[model samples]
Target: MTGTPLTTILIVDDEPQIRRFLRPSLAAQGYAVVEAASGEEALARAAEAKPDVIILDLGLPDLDGIEVIRRLREWTEMPIVVLSVRSREADKIAALDAGADDYVEKPFAMGELLARLRAALRHRLRQAGEAPIFRAGALAVDLVRREISLAGEPVKLSPKEYELLRLLVQHAGRVVTQRQLLKEVWGPAHVEDTQYLRVYIGQLRDKLGDDATKPHLIATEPGVGYRLLVELAGDAQR
Candidate 1:
C-alpha cells in the first residue's frame, strides 16, 4: 500500500523487541517511525520531531506514561495511543485524563492497532475542517478554514477542544452520549470518565461565551451527554 505522504508516528517503549516489531509494520503501512526508549527521551523527541501520532508504552524507566502524556499535552496536540500491560479501568481512566487519545492492551493484534490508527487519522482530518462552514447567531464555525468566530472575533481552541467541538457540530441536534464523546476524544479506554467530559464541556462553553444556565448552541441532556443546537436554516454540507 502507498504510504500517507506526510504521516509520521513515534513509538516510545523500553523494549527493543517491541520497537523492532512495530517499526516494519508501521513503515509498511506508510508511516515514518521514530523510536524512543525512555520517557525523558520520548519527551525530547516529541518536542523536536513533532510526530503526527504517538504509540506510547505506559511503563518507562524515567517517568510514568501518564506524566509523559501530561507533559506532552502542555505543549502539543498530537494523537497519543498508550500501550500497556495494565487492563484495569482506573488505569485507563488515568491515562485518558493525562491526555492520551487511545489505549491498547499489550499483546494486541497488529491489524487492530492499524485500524485504530486509521480511525484516529480520519477523525483528525474531519476535525481539521474538510467540509463547508456553518453559522448560528453570532457564532460562526468555518469548517473548511478550521476557525471559530464569536460575533466576528476569532475564538482560539486547543487541538482537543477543536476536535470535541467538531464532533458536536457534525452531530448537531443529537444528544451525544458521554461514552461517545470520551471514545472519540480521549479514546476507547476513557468512556467512563464523565467528570472529564463535564469539565471540558464547561470550558468550551465558557470560551464560546455561552451561558451555562441557558446555552444557545450547546445543551446538556441531564444524565446523558451534550448536544449542539444548529440554528442555521440551510444544509451545511460537511
Candidate 2:
C-alpha cells in the first residue's frame, strides 16, 4: 500500500452552492472532503477534520478570509487555496501573505483549481525534505548534489543564488514571503534585506532563461513575494 493516507480537503465557504459544487468534484478525485460554512466553523472544523489541504473563501459571513488564513498559519501549515470573487491584485496579495498557498478567483476553471491544489500539496511534501530531484519543465534541480540544469545544460549559480533557488524549489508552488527568504538565505539579521532578493531573483531568472516581463517559471506576487510556477514542468513530481 501507499505510505501516504487519503488526503482530506476542507472547503470553507459560507455559500451552500459553493460547497455543493466542490464536494463532488473533489470526491471524484478520491479526496475526502469536509465542509465549513463560516470563518468560526472553518477554524473549528479545520481542527476536527485535520484536512491535508484547505479551500477557503475570503468573503465569509463572520470573519474575513484573510483572518482565517492568519489564525490557521499560527498553528498549522496546511496548504490553503483561497477561492474568492475578489480579483483585485491587492486582495490576492493579502490572502497569500496571510499564508494561503494559492489563490483562484471566482468563476474559476475546475481543472486549474485542481492543478493548483495538487501543486500546493506537492510543495508541502517537498518542504518536508522528502524529495531529492525537482523537475520543472526542462529545468531540473538536484538538491542532493546542489545542481540546477536547464534543458540538459548545467546552469551556473552563485552560492546565494543556489540557496535561494533551493528554498523556492523546496516550496515550489507556494508564495515564499520576502522576510522568510531573506532570513533563511542571508541570516536572521538580514530579514529586512528585501533588495537582496530583488537582485538575486533577477540574476536567477536571467540564468534560468526566464524573462521577468513574461515569466514562465518565477512569477512575482507583487508587494508580497515570489512564487515559482512550473505546472508544465510537472512541479517536481518526477
Candidate 3:
C-alpha cells in the first residue's frame, strides 16, 4: 500500500533565511514545503501548489500579508497562519479579521510555531465537516443543538451572549476581532460600540463560570479581540 500523501505547506516570506529556516523543519515532519518570496508570487504559487496550509509573513515586498489574505479568501478557504515581526495588537487583529486562521509573532519558539501550524491544519479539517463539537477543559459546545455545557452541567446564556460564544466557537483557537464580533452579533451600526461587547462578554463569563481575571475559557486579546480557548473545532449554533 502507498503511504499517506504529505500535507503541503506554503511558506510565504520575502526573506530567504526565513524560508530556509522553515523548510527543513517542516520537511522533517513529513510536510511538503512550497516557498514564495512576494505576495504576487505567493498568489501564483498558491494557485499552482494548492498547499494545504499557508504560513505568511506580513511584510512582503509587493503587498501586505493582510491584503494577500483578503485576496486569497475571495476564492479559497485555506488556513493561513501568520508569522510577523509586528508586535502591535492591531496588526494581529487585522490579520485574523482578514481571514487568516492564526498568528505567531517573530522570533517565535519553533515549538509554538509548529503548534500553531498544526492547529491551523486541524481548523481547516474541522471546516471540511470533520468536527461538530468544540471542547476545551470542562467547556463543551454542541453545534448541532446549540447546546453548551461546563463540567457536564448545562449552561444557559442569553441571546447576545450565546451569539457571541457561538461566534467564538466557530473560530475556536483563532482570534475574532472586536469589530468582526460586534458587526456579526450586533449589526453594522454597532461595529464601533466596544461597550456592548464588554457588557455581554461579562455576562457570558458569569453564566459560563469563566473567571474574568484568570479566565480559562474565553481570553480577551486586550485591545484586539477575543479568542475562545478550544481544541480547533462548528455551525450556525443557533
lDDT of each: 0.78, 0.88, 0.85
Error of 2 at 119 (Å): 0.4
TM-score per model over all chains: 0.58, 0.81, 0.87
In model 1, which regions exceed 4 Å deviation? 1-4, 130-237
Question: Which 10 consecutive residues of model 1 have the lowest summed lDDT?
Answer: 229-238
The parts of candidate 2 lying over 4 Å away from their true place are 1-5, 178-199, 211-214, 222-224
Backbone clashes in model 1, listed as residue pairs:
none
| Model 3 lDDT per residue over 1-238, tens place | 1147889999999999999999998888888999999999999999999999999999999999999999999999988999999989889988988899888889899887887777677666666774577777777888778898988999988878889998887776777889999999999999999999999999998988888788777888788888776532222222
Model 3 sits at a Cα RMSD from the real structure of: 3.5
- Stretches of candidate 3 exceeding 4 Å from the true structure: 1-3, 130-132, 212-214, 231-238
**Cα RMSD (Å) between model 2 and the true structure?**
3.4
Better of 2 and 3 by lDDT: 2
Which of the numbered candidates is closest to the native, going by highest lDDT? 2
